[model samples]
Target: MPNITVQLLAGRDINQRRAFVKDVTDSAVLTLGARRGDVRIVFEEITPDTVANGGVLASEDDSRAEVVSRFVPQASS
Candidate 1:
């Protein structure tokens, strides 16, 4: 059995999470010789305010803006 844990900022769609879990399970089955039923994946979603970098909350840190930008889709102008 293989267990995997992933943590990310909140707001990802449920479909996206499901796809991630499926992909991880498939990888474990192929690369680790684990059965799909024996592979477990857990996702933890946290708010930006709960994460801190450089002693500053992610919600308040300007430096983290670029990093977070990658995870969030850009809105049309």
Candidate 2:
């Protein structure tokens, strides 16, 4: 049995996760000699507000403006 963990920003839809997990599992089964039924995968979704880079929260980081914007709704001008 093999345990795999993945962490990413929360926002991607379930379809993306499913596709990723399927590919990862297939690769593990083929390359790691792991049984398809015995491979365990875990996903940890983190909110932008909970992460920081360069001492600035991702929710407030200017460098992440474009990436963060994808998960947040913009104000009407």
Candidate 3:
């Protein structure tokens, strides 16, 4: 059995996560000869406030603004 863990800031939709897991599972099956049932994948979501770069919190990091925008809630019109 192969176990995989992925960590990223939250905000991705179900479709994106589903596709990612499918592709990873396919690769494990093909490269490691692992059965579908034996493959495990875990996703860990961290918030911007919990992470920092260059001693600056991600939530306040100007350099990460573009990437962080993806996780920000969209305003309804």
Task: Provide TM-scores for the models.
Answer: 0.75, 0.80, 0.84
Largest TM-score belongs to which candidate?
3
Candidate 1, 34-75: lDDT as tens digits = 999999888888766778988898877888787666665445
Clashing pairs in 2: none
* lDDT value, residue 16 of candidate 2: 89
Note each model's CA RMSD in angstroms: 4.3, 2.6, 2.9
| lDDT by residue (tens digit), candidate 3, 1-77 | 99999988899899999999999999999999999999999999988888999999988998998998888653478
> Which is the better candidate, 2 or 3, if ranked by lDDT?
3
Q: What is the lDDT of residue 40 in candidate 1?
A: 86
lDDT (Cα, tens digit) per residue for candidate 2, span 1-77:
99999978877788988999999999999999999999899988877788998899988888998987786555588
- Model 2 TM-score is 0.80
Candidate 3 global TM-score: 0.84
Off by over 4 Å in 3: 74-77
lDDT of each: 0.83, 0.87, 0.91
Top candidate, metric lDDT: 3
